[model samples]
Each structure stands twice: as C-alpha cells, then as structure tokens.
Target: MKKLAFLVLLIVTVLSGTLVGKAIASTGFDAYSMTTHKIENGNLTNKVTDLISFTSQNIENEKNNDSKLVSINNVSDNVIDSSLSTDEEILQELSRYKDLENTYLMQPGWTSITFDQYDLLPLNSPKPLPSQYRKEFWSHFDGNQKVTEQVDYLISSETGKVPLGVFVNGELTSLWNDGQKVKKDPYTPAYDLYLVSSIQTLVESNSPLELSFKQEILANQSVSLIELRTQFSTTDKQWINIQLDKPVWGQYEKFTFNSQTGLLLKYEHYYVLDDMSLVLSSVTDNFEYSVASEAPSDVTNLIATGGK
Candidate 1:
C-alpha cells in the first residue's frame, strides 16, 4: 500500500511537468494543425546498448551513402525520401520551434496535446505500478498545457470537453461548463516567455543511434514509408545542474516519415529514468502533424468564445 502511494506521488509530479508551455500566437491560419502525445515511463530495463560515441569522427560516414540508399518499391504516401534522414527532420522540427514567435495548443479536436503518464516499476519491489491501473488513473487529469511559452493554463478532458481555464492578455478566469467566464485563479505572469527566447546556446544535439533497424511499407494510399529506429538528445545553455546524475536523458524514437515530401506523419519518443532506489521509469511522446485547409469547429468555437 505504501509503495502504491509513492508511485502515485511520483506520477503526479512528473505528469504535471509534461503539460503546459507558451503557444504560438494565433495566425488565423486554419490550415495549420497538430496533435502532441507525451508518454511518461518509470521502468528499469536489464537490456543495454553501448551506443556509439557522440564525437565528430565516430558519426556515420555519409560520403558514399548514396550507394547504400534504402529503397522500397512497393510505396505510397507515407514514405520518407532519401534526400533527408529522419534525424535531420527531427532537428528541423525542433529548430522550427525555436524560430516560432507564438505557438498554441489544446484546441480540442484541432490542435491539442494528449499527455499519458506510465509507471513501470516492479509491483513487488515497491516501485513499479501495474500497467493495467495506469490507464484509468491517468484518464482523470486536470492540465493547462498549451503551445505557448508558459505552463499556467488548465484543461480537463473529463470536464465538458473544452478548455475551462482561459487567460486574457495576462489575466486568468475560469469558464464554467456553460461557456461563461467566472472567478478562478486571477493571476498571470508578465510578458516573459519560458523557453523560446531565453536559451543562448544548444550545448549539444546528438543522435545516439544510427540505422539500428529499418522497415519499409506503403501507407495512406501511396506514400512511401521508411521506418527508422533512431535516438537523439539535446542540451541547452540555460540548463542548470540540479544535482542529477545524468543531465542528458536521451530519447529512443521511432519515426515514420513520408518519403515523398520528407514529412513526418507519426513518431514516438521514449525516455527512461531510475530513482535512487531501484525504481525505473520511462516516458514517451507520440507526435502527429497535418496540413489542413480549415480548423475544427470545436477549436473555432473555443476561440470564438475567447477560449471559453
């Protein structure tokens, strides 16, 4: 019983951190769309891979890479082209985040991020929470995650299927189920962004794995798909040492890209951590992006009502 309580506590803490950040300003471009998924893991694994060194000389030699090009003849719309690798695409996206002035999230069916937290410590060891119970427990969450540059918003899927917490310029007011603003948390921060403009340097950006495995398939009526099991890590100059053993927690990502346009249709980001005591945890993010001609009604309505 005590172990279960502890597991709950850890999950609550990390889960809260997974949600929220400043969002891109509204561009009124209904065609832009996105879906963000975050998976939190806290499980240990006995399996290990002695990844290659991140030094310049040890990286993959792409000189004659054209001869080693991976081709899939039976392809469609989901395939990734040979010109750019998956690692390059990911770096491009993260860099795009850096250039964006304002980003937005939590738009119901349109632009929203779904955060799922999981605890995979062994139950007998007073660490691992059973996977079966995680679904239901995590299903009930109150979050204020957005694409903006801050983490002070609130939304609950369990509540009327809308973002109940609304912030206007710098003021937060609670919106009830009837879509009316009411008094809630009356605080907001000044015009300070959390991540985008603060960091001066990208200390290190490295891909830990190269060509561990690859698969080819046809998806979406003809896009060629090249599935790559890749890994990456990045450090920023603004990061301060918090007495953690390894400041760099790498991601084991599975990417599925459309070979034609060099676009990423879907991908999963996984990371693991271990507590001082024998408890190990893992986190994952499943991300999806699309180009639409219009925004969903739910999101449009939310904006129409001043984020009500």
Candidate 2:
C-alpha cells in the first residue's frame, strides 16, 4: 500500500511540473514563451532567407519601361507655322493644345512629365478617389510559438482621411483619428499600429506602390487613378510625410478626418528627410474586438441581470 501511494505521488509530481512549466512559458510578453528558440540558428530560417533574397533579386531585374520626359522635346512640335495668325487665333490654338495636354497627363502608362506642363493645368482638377472603407487582415509568428493576428481599417472621405479603427483580439482599445472606437487587444499596441498603417497606406495611394506584377495591370487600367498607397517618414498632429520616388508620381497627404462621424480622408503635402531613405519607423497599435454576442456567457448574464 505504501509503495502504491509513493508511485501515485511520483506521477502527480511529474504532471504538476509539466503544467507549471507550460504556464510559465505562456505568461510572458504577448503571451509568448520567453525562452523559445529563435530562427537565427534554425535550418528553416536559412531556407526562408534564401527564398526571400531570390525573390527580391528577380523583382529588381524587371526593368521599368516608362519613358521619362525631362525637357521640351520639340519646340515647334505643336506650333502652327502661320505668321499671319491674329491674337484670337493664337489664343484659340493655345486652348486647343491645353486640352490635349490634359488628355496626355491622364493617359495610361504615363509616369512623369515636365513640371511646367503640370502647372499649366487648373489646380482644382479632380484627382483619384478612394473607396469608403478598406480592411486588411494579417497573421505571422512572432519568433515564439504563438501566432499574432491583426485587423486594420482605413476609413476615408471626400475631404480628409485617417485610420478609423483596428482589431487585435476582440476588445475595444485605442481611438486615434477621431473618437472612433478601435477594438483590439491591450497588450499588443505596437502590432496593431503596424497593421493599421500598412493597410491605410495601401488604401490611400493614387497608384500601386508595392512593386509587383499587379502594378502593371493597375497602370493599364483607367480606374488605377483611384488606387491608394501611403508611406510614413514622420508623424504630427496635422501633417504626415509619405515617401515617394518622384514628386510628380503622387502627393503625400496628412491623415485627416471628420470629428463627428470620423469619416474624412484627404492627403496634404509633407516633407521628407534629406537622407532620402525610404524606410519609415513607426510603432504598432495592437488590439482586438468582440461583438456583444461574442462576449463571455458570464458577462452577458451579468448584463442581463443588471438590466432587471
């Protein structure tokens, strides 16, 4: 009988040790194990690195065929060599060419043009527009065994634009653009920010920003004008600096929104640093959201009882 009791105790002790170890491993930052193995020394890490490097090299090799207009190609290309023309006739001719110039500016596959030509057009000309709202979901392993999930939304309007909300794990957390509630996990704010910014930038761009085969299709399509992309160099109360390869390619606008419904999406000019690097360092806003129906039964029961 004593031997049997000792064996049972030994079994219980072993199980307890296992349980305790698991609990400790899962209690650290972001609910990930603190002592988990890193990819730096793993075989899979080397394979992933090689694959990424190969893909990047192939992308760089794809040459851009868009012609760049640097200066006046032909001074008399559009000129009518009529010395007898009156002032009215000259003005009429100029107006006709101005319309053609605007058409060329809006043509497909047109990447860059002279600044003088762009300035000759009216300032209030309508540019590309974005959809009402855009949502994106991303998941990745954070070095640890745990996988992180993020959901971001870009809410835009006719006059201003801003990041409306985010969801990390079914909970309401930070509200940035206006007082719109962004539901997310409280523990992973940085992760939320990264996902939100990435989606917002993509949805706000006038053209495809990411270098991919999709950009070719976008360039060919007339509706490509409405496509949105964004990058961050700096952040401020009323302004944001979005990086671009060329100024004429697109305009970087500050993220703005309506105070009431939190539905404004507009872009304004901002400056880039002199260093000219494309990377933008920013924090992540990580969180999650849950609908009332999705809440715990105990919480719902409490709410129902309190209403009585």
Number of the top-ranking candidate, with TM-score as the measure:
1
List, residue by residue over 76-151, the lDDT tens digit for candidate 2.
1222234323333333433343343333222221111101001110111112113122222222223332323322
Listing every candidate in turn, what is its Cα RMSD in Å to the true structure after a full C-alpha superposition? 14.4, 24.9
Q: Report model 2's TM-score to 2 decimal places.
A: 0.17
Which consecutive 10 residues in model 2 have the weakest lDDT in total? Answer: 113-122
**lDDT, candidate 1, residue 277?**
17
Position 34, candidate 2: lDDT:
12
Error of 1 at 81 (Å): 9.8
Q: Write the per-residue lDDT of candidate 1 for residues 230-275, one digit (tens) a residue.
A: 2222321112111223332322333343333333333332332232
> Where does model 2 exceed 4 Å of error?
1-208, 211-238, 241-274, 278-280, 283-294, 298-308
Angstrom error of the Cα, residue 51, model 1: value is 24
Give the least accurate 10-residue stretch of model 1, judged by summed lDDT: 27-36
Candidate 1: residue 262 Cα off by (Å): 4.7
